[model samples]
Every structure is written in C-alpha cells, then in structure tokens.
Target: MAMIHDSIVKEDVVEHKLGFYPRIPADSIFTRENVTARTKLRAHLNTPLHLATMENKPNSIALLLSMGCRLSYNNLDMSAIDYAIYYKFPEAALAMVTHEQRAKEVMALRSDRHPCVTLALIAYMPRVFEAVQDKCITKANCKKDSKSFYIKYSFDALCPQLKMEDGNNVRRKSENVPKSQNIPLPALNIKYSFKFYQRSKLEVDALRLALNDPKYRPEPLCVINAMVAHGRVELLAHPLSQKYLQMKWHSYGKYFHLANLLFYCIFLIFVTVYTYLLMGSSENYSHTKKAAKCNLSDPMTFDRENKTEKNNVFNSDFESKVAMYTSTVAILAYNAICLIREAYNVKQQKWHYLVDPSNLVSWLLYISSTLMVIPTICNYFEEIQFSAASITVFLSWFELLLLLQRFDQVGIYVVMFLEILQTLIKVLMVFSILIIAFGMAFYILLSKVGPDETGHHLSFNSIPMSLMRTFAMMLGELDFVGTYVQPYYKSETDILLPFPMPTFFILGIFMVLMPILLMNLLIGLAVGDIESVRRNAQLKRLAMQVVLHTELERKLPAILLEKVDKDELIEYPNNKKCKLGFLDLILRKWFCNPFTDDAGLDLVLESSEDYITAELEKQKRKLRDISLVLEQQHTLVRLIVQKMEIKTEADDVDEGVSPGDTRVVPRWSSPRIRKKLRTASSFNK
Candidate 1:
C-alpha cells in the first residue's frame, strides 16, 4: 500500500507505463489476478477497502481511494459503504459517500435501493405470524443464493471445500455464524453500491429543503405514519415529526385504532370486574350479607333467626374476599397503565387535556375513586362509597359508548343520541317554567292544608319536596301514595288530610301538568331529530371517529408518535444480531454446540498450521511419482512418432515426390525418458 507513495518521491528506482500507470520489474512474480496482492490475514474477494474497514484505518481508506479503488462498487457480499456502516465505520462511510458520485460514472448500475420511507415501515412492523413452515423471509440461518453458504467443521477434502459451497454469503451449518455482510437489497436501484442509499442525506432533509424543492418534502402525515409503523420513537427529535406527531392525532389510523381497541377491551374487563367487587361481592360486608347484596340482586337475606347458620362447602364469604383481592390488584395494575397512557395524551395534544371527553371521564373516575378511599377504609358511609362505585360503572360503559363512535355501523346510534339531546335543549326553558309553577302551586296548597296525621307534610312540606314529587310524576311514577303518602306515614295514618293529602292535588294538577302534558311534549319535540340523524349517518360517524381518533392518539407514547428518517434508524439496533426461530432453538439444544462458530474455516486454518511441514513433504512425494510415470509415457510416444515420420519420408521417395510434399504430426520428448531408459538398461545387464 505504501509503495505508490514511496515510488512517487524516489524516482531513481521507479518505473511507469505511459508516464502514468505504475510498472513493476520483471522479477515480480505476482500479477493482477494473484489472490494475494501483497496481503496478510485476508479472505476471498478481499480488497483494500475491506481491509481499511476491518482494521478501522481511515487513512488506509483514503490511500485506497487514491489508488483508483471503488468504494460503492459491488463487493463480494457487502459493498464497502454498507460494510463500513454495518461495522460502525462512520468516517469510512462518509468518505465513500463522497466518492459515490464519481463511482456512478464508472460502473454500470444494476438496481436501486429502498428509500428511507419504505425501509422504516418494513423494519419496525412485527413479523407476520405463521403457523406452519415458512420457506423464506428469514433473518438468518437459511442459505442465500446457495449451494449452502458455509460448510461445517468436519474432516473432509484437504485443500478446501468446493467453491460452489459458498454463495454471496456463507450459510454455515451453524446458523449463528454471521457469514453474509451483504445488504444488496432488491428495493434499491443499486447505483453506486445501492446498499448505501439508506444513509443518503435526502430523507431527513425533506423538511429542511421543503421550500426550495417541493418534491423533496414528504407529507407530515407520511413521516408520522412511517415513524409509527417502524417504531422509530427516537425521531421525535426532528422538528417536523414533533409538530405533526403532537397535532396529527389521527395519523397511523389503522394501527392506532387497533392498539387502542385492544387496550380498551382490557381496561373494560378489569374495570367491570372491579366495580362488581366493590358494589356487592366484597367480604367487608359479608356479615351483613343482607347489606352485601348488590342493587342488581334482591335485598340481602339475614339468617339471624337461625341460632347458627351452617358454613357451606365453598365458604362463599372467603371466596368473595379472594375475588376482591385479586380483582383489586388487577384493577390497580390496569388503571396504572391507563393513567400513564392518558398522561401521554395530555403531552401530545395539550388541548386534549381539557377537551377530550375520555380524558374528562378518566379524571372523573380518578376523583370518585379518590373520594371513596376514605369511606371504604373506615367502613362507614357505604352510600358515599357506592356513589363513587356507581360513577365508575357509568364511566366504564360511557367510555365503551364513546369507542363505538369509531364503528361505522353502530356509530349512528351515538350520533342519534347526541343529536336528540342537543335539539331537546331548546325546550328546557318551557319545561322549567311549567315545573316551577306546578311546584309552587303544590307547595302553597299542601302547606296551607297542613301536616298529615303522622305530624309530617306528605304532599308538600317545602318547595323542594313538591318539586321532587312533580318530577317523579313526569316519569310516570303516578302512585301518589308511594311517592307522597308512605314517606310521611307513621303507620299508614299520615294519609289523614283535608280532601285526601296528595291524591287530589296529584290527580287534579300534578299528574295533569307534569307527566300528562310537559313530559310528553318534551319527547314530542326531540322525536324530530331521528330521521335527520339517520340520513347522514356516514358523515356523522366520520366526525365522531375523528373526535375519538384524536383522543386515542393521545394515549400512545410520544416516542411512537414521533417521526424518524428510515435511513437513520435501520441500523438503530446496534447488535445487528437476529433472533433465532423455533426450529433453530430446538436444533441447537439437541444436535451440536461448538465454542466459536467460525463458519467451519477455523478447522482448515487450524489443521493447515498444525501439519504444515509433514503435509508438504507428503504432497511432494506423490507429485514426484506422477512425474516419473508421465516421463515413461512421453518416451514411448516420442519413439512411435519418429518411426512414423521416417516411414512418411520413404513413401515420399517411392512416389518420386519432393520431401517438402510430406507432412508429419508433432510428438513429445523428455530427458527424463532417456535417464529412465539407461537406468532400465543397466538393471537388465
């Protein structure tokens, strides 16, 4: 390598062809085709760039480039530029990148490489699951352009394995041995060693150069979608990625939808089960089994009358406690994940912290659960505890309803409900007036009639009571005795009143104005919204989904939401080692295990050194015997040819033809033949 520089300064011993190309003396035994062009510790297809890369010598790379070596040309496996990058030779890679332009002019291009966008998506996406055998699409092990990439370390032919045994890479029987350094991917248009295309400056600069060259600018959504799909969360550092990732909540639509849907199902299940435990199945109220009954079931049954209730086989109380313990733990764990996701949402879309309904529901749940903690721990105010409990149940179901907004079919139901509710707001003023007037009339009449026999007002003790009764009537709770008579009665005696307490007022005015007129009129007005909602289901659902998508996008980690250039992150994983498949795992466990899988080359290397002296002598002896046999054969052939030539000359004389007219074929001769003849003649004597 130093010879070029050495000769340049010392012209006395230097020679040149055409005053430019270097020339060697006649004594030089090696030529251009020789495997070793003054090399050591090298393999087949070895070149100066490969040496520079392996040695981590940047100066050597520059030297080789000056010597007219191409960095981006097709190397045996990896082009030099890709090899440098894979080996973490950044300086070498940069140097090659500079020379790439000139290389294109010299070498005929074959194919193109995948741009940053395509590779980022492909690299990060999870491998598709296959149930049975997959013949291709492997990260390692399987042969490449193969006759079997690499050979096993076994006793075999002495010189070397057949050349055909190895392909572009060595697929050694030991799958872990990484034989191929090749990155000649099909997606690239392979000009100037297209493998280096991934590191091209164009991709990440798309945003920077957007104004100058519109074509260079990728869509904000495209960068985001690619980043999400490829899992290059680190790219959030890019300004464009940061801007779009935070705002474009609906980016990565399908993947985002699926991810949230899965998490939502899990959250719903745990929340549902936990809510059940808190409401009824908890062992805290086991003694009050009658109190233990949830609202969904009949009132708890107390068996105090029985001197002792026998324990059942299942010990229902203890089992219920166990269920409570486990469900509580699971709920806590899942809730933590939910909170983290929601917090991430707030970070990505700052406005979502206040505007998103799901976020609002999550905050409500947090507050309610926090409020219930004291009541639950002290074992008092079961009503307060269950009120919070009720909130969780309502929120869980409501959250699911919001998720339904994303479903194209059932999404229309959400639209209809919201539309009807919004339209009903217009009638609220009229309804409020009627409710107030009716309540005031009832209060005046009932208080004027005085308390019933129980010494309490059943019809109207206050304006609040009158209002509550009137509102209940609107819901068709028309049993005035249940609503007004029972509460004030101390033995059904409170019914004693002038003209029958609440019945006359309920019949004459309350029932007529509340349920019969106002309540019916409210429904009649909102009923008009259903047809309008049904007609525009698609657009309405889309709007709802857009809203939902924005919220769900906030749940993702900001890292996943960020944009990274595909090229920068392809080799992001430093190890570059691929994980093994099921078959490989099994084979490794059972078959064979070696210290270091040198792809079988170690055996040849070791054996040649160990037996070098003896092996050379043995080969020489074999060659000598073959040479002697060849000399004897040549002697016989030479004698036969000479006799034929003499016969041809005599035939020419008999025919009276000129000697020049005769023709003779060539034959062989050797001094070794005469030496062998003499040795044989002396032996016969």
Candidate 2:
C-alpha cells in the first residue's frame, strides 16, 4: 500500500492533505490485516499536530491540541516541536512549549524555578557544565590549587560555611575542604564570594528533554545566560525568569553607560571624517609625499603606478588630521572600556554573558574597529582603512538598533524584523536544493550542446553562469537572442534548438515546478506561517529587549556597581535575607541549620503553586458539571425514543393489523412485559 501509485491515491477522498478525516483529528488504528498485538494502532499513529506544523498552520496547532489527541507517538514525538520551530512554526512551537510548561507545573508541584529559566539552563547552557561541576572537587583538591587566584578566592568564600544540606541529609562537606586555594575558580569573583545554586534532578531532566525534544520547550531568547547567571528584563515576564532576573542586578548603576555610548558615537564621527578624507575628495593626493610610508621628505606623485600614496587628504587638511588623531584616541579608550566592562559582566553573570547575540554583534564591530586602527597608525592603505571603517560603521548601526530595542515600540518591530528575516532565509534555504538541482541539470544539458562555432556561450559557459541565467529566468529574464540564439545559431535566420527535448523538459519543469508552482508553494507556506509567527511576537520582542538592556546595564560606571539596594535584590529562587545581626551571621556558620535562609525563604513559590493548583481544581469542577449535564441529556434522548415507539405501536393497532402478528420494532421494554401479567392493558395505559 505504501508503494502504490501516489497519483491514484490522490484521487481518493483522504488524499487531500488539508482537511481530510474532519471528524477523526488523530489517525485511526491501521490494523485490519492481522488483528494481533503486533498490528496495533500504536505502531501507525499519525497526528494533526504533525500535519498542522508541516502545513504552516500554527494557528491550527492549538485547535488540534484542543481535540485531545496524544501528542507523543513515534510519528510525532517531543522533537516535533523543535522541527516546527526550525521550520519557522513559532506558534505551533509555542503551543508545544506552553503544554510542556503546564505539564511541568503540574508535575513539579512546588518547584520554585520558572519554566523558561529551567529551560534555558537545560537547553542553552553547555551540557558540559554539569560534568565540569562534578569534576570541580578534583580541580579544587589539586595540590597547586592555592597557586591560582580564583581557586584561592573561592576557597576563602566557601571556608566560612562548615555544614551543608543535600536533600534529607546534612553533610559537613565544607569541614574537610581546604579554605585557602589560589586558583581563580571559574564561578568566583575578585570579591571572593561563592553562592552555589542547586537544581533538582527532575528540573535538570526537564531542561535536558526541553533541549533535545521539540515538544519540550523553546530556545531561550537569543541564547542569553540562564536567569541564575545574570538577569535580562525579559525574564521578568515569567515567575521563574523573574526570580533569576531579580537575583541578578536590577538597574544600570551610573551615567557612565551614557558616556560609553557617547564614546562610540565619537568614534563613529571620527571614522566618518577619516572616510571622507580618504574617499570623499578627488585630486587631494597631489600635495602628499610619494613614499611607502606617509611621513617622508619627497614630492608626492599619485598616478597609475603609485596608487598607494593617493587619497592622503589628512596630509593637506589640518582639521582632518585633528579629527583623525582625536578619533584614534577615542577608539582606543572605547575599546579598553568595552573590554573591561565585558570582563566585569562575565565575572558577575557567569558563563551566560557570552551567549548573547547582541554581544557577538558588538564584538564583530569592535574587531572591525580594531582592524581599522592598523591602517590608521601606518597612515597608509587608505583604501583598506576606508573599507574597514565603512563595514564597522554599518555594523554599528545594527548595534544601535540592538540598543534601541530597550524602547518597547521600536524594539518590538526590530525583533519582528529580525525573526521575519531569519524565517525568510530558512524558507529560501528549503528551495535552494531545487534551485541547485535545476541549475546543475541545466548546466549539464547546455554544456553538451553549448554555443555555435563562434564560441558565443551566453549562459551555458559555466555552472555559475547557467545558475544565474536560470535564476534570472525565474525572475522573468529569458533572453532569446543571448541564451538560445547566440548559443545554438545554426545559420543567420535559422537556429537549431540545442537538446530540444531536454530544453523543453527542463524549461517546462523549471517554469512549472519552480517559478509557477513552487513559487506558490513558498508563498502558501509563508502566508500560512504568518499568524503563527505573529503569536510569538511579544515573547520575541521581550527576548530582544532583554539582550539589549543586559548589554547596556553592564556598561554602567564602576562606582555604581556597589550601590545595589537590598530591596531591589530580593527576587524569587535566589532571594536571601541580609545578615544584619550577629545571630544572622552565626546562623550562616552551619549548613545543617533547619532554618537555612536558602530554602523556601520566599512566599512567591508557595503562592504560585497554590494559584496553579486552584486553577486546575477549578477547571476539573467545570468538567464534572459538564459531564453531569451530558448524562441528563442522554436520559432525555432515551425517553424521547421510547415515546416515539409507543406512538407507533398504537398506530399499528388502529390500522387493523392481525392480533397474532408481532411488531419488529426494537425491544424497548422486554423486562417490563415479563414482570407484568396483564400485559396488553397495562402497557396501553
């Protein structure tokens, strides 16, 4: 059956992919053959969840979900969610993510972590981190541990605590460990403080599944650090993320953040002026010295041979030189500040700081800026200087857009643009295979019968050339004289169509399958996905804004880093009481203390669990009421059928049917007739 002609099967009622089996939302058991355990429905389970995603009906995903079909089967397992996401089905993926979140909330009961944060920790963070943590004991126990700055600092922080609790048991793990290590431990700071946040096995498993299974969860927005490492404003949206966000910094500490921006702006201004000096005017190289180096005592001659000495406008203009000098100084200062700021953020935020796309984009621009400096210092290779500066300047605009994302209105659209572009590229990538196959096919056919004796191969000369021709043809650029006439001209007015059969088939297929038919397919897929894409807009915007804000917040003046308020610092999962009293300090000495501040120290988790439980209970009650109503309606329907039967029996008697004749009506009261001796009279009444 699987190998049957697809065309013949399409002629059947079920082959229309969109809305077939309208009543049966999920696939039925395909087990008519053997009717044994091996031939069960489980083996061939198909689901509308799979259908909805592949069809780009993300809007329909939730609708299908409401139909109560099993989401996880061999055909559509948890990874299906990721497949949807990878193919740009954001809404469908969102539905899957939300379902996973709900399931976790129900299962975990009172787990304090946000689903998103839990997800990020599991998905975005290196899987290697767990292994790294496991080996930290051996690393810390190394004989030369004290030689490293971080190891020494972290040991000093961990030494003050003598006892620790692991679940139901309390262990004095800290007592046996060295208190004076020198290595700069990966998770520590210059302040020599260490706060170990714990995650349960269940949470870790959930996160792990989220990364591997499509149905498990969505990717953390732009792959930022988990909320535990640092904070993004977007994390504030979810209770779990909010907890992590609160644990991290709440605000930019100083006006120096503004100063850094101004510095970059100053750098850009200088770069623009330098670009103008290099490329803005013509014949300005006349006054410059003709030397490999910019500084020399010689007459400047810039022509075809000595092009390197050309465009030295800075040599002639005093202000351009001043701008050049000032810009160089600004660039150096900005680079140093950015580098230091990033390092500070990494120390405070942990490994998550490096995962941000915005940071990566900034790094590219910074590197470009740094490269431009080499040319600037030598005061040579003006073209290279101009080229590098232009690229840096363009990328800086993107960085600006990233920064502007802190503003909601602008951020939302920019986020939409980024996602849309990403999705479009993915869409184009799908069609690339067909494009390449067609291009290769066309190239082979044309190369076989390419060009006249004059060797005028219009597009058949090379694969790239044929690909461009095919692409142009797809865009309605078919050149008869150039493509066909020049290549296959038999004589002045007569021309033999090269590989007429292949040409016809190739062109026909390319036009029909790709440009005409396949083009519509692309449009349908994209259009189908638009609503699904729109569904994720808010979360996507939040994710982008968080990235931008996190970057800016890190650049605040050094003085402001120490002025954090205790009130603002209090957030979920990571909340702790300030140790103001001597007793508070004393309580921290033993990890075995029953009233450990780290455990259940906040009411938020408990309250959130209660709210979720109450909501679930409320829904269950409503379903119970609905079931009762359905039962009553069923009883009413049975009574109506009985009444109709009794009426029909009476009509039969009036029509003078034979007395011994039996009515073939379905038995409604066989037991009632048996119980009553005076059957006719009693039944008539």
Q: Pick the candidate with the highest lDDT.
A: 2
Model 2: per-residue Cα lDDT over 1-685, one tens digit each: 4533332233222323346445532233233232233224325544455656666664466555554534442443323443454465544545543442232221121111222222333344322222222222221333332433112111111111212334565332212222222222111121221222222223334444534542332222222345323433333343333323222322331133344555667766766665566563323443343233544334354243255433453365667667766777777777787888777877867877677666788788878887876766766565666677778878877777665444444555666566556676887788778878888887776664545533335575688887887777776676756666554555353334556577667777787777787667766766656666577664554454455445543444323432331111211222232433443243234212112223322422335777798799899979987998999899998899898864557445656666768677656567766567567768898
For candidate 2, the per-residue lDDT at 316 reads 58
The most accurate candidate by TM-score is: 2
lDDT of 1 at 508: 73
| Model 2: ten consecutive residues of lowest lDDT | 151-160
What does candidate 1's lDDT look like per residue over 603-645, in tens digits? 2123556679668878997898799889989998889989786
| Backbone clashes (count) for model 2 | 19
Return the lDDT, model 2, position 490: 56
TM-score of each: 0.40, 0.43
TM-score of model number 2 = 0.43
What's the alpha carbon RMSD for model 2?
22.5
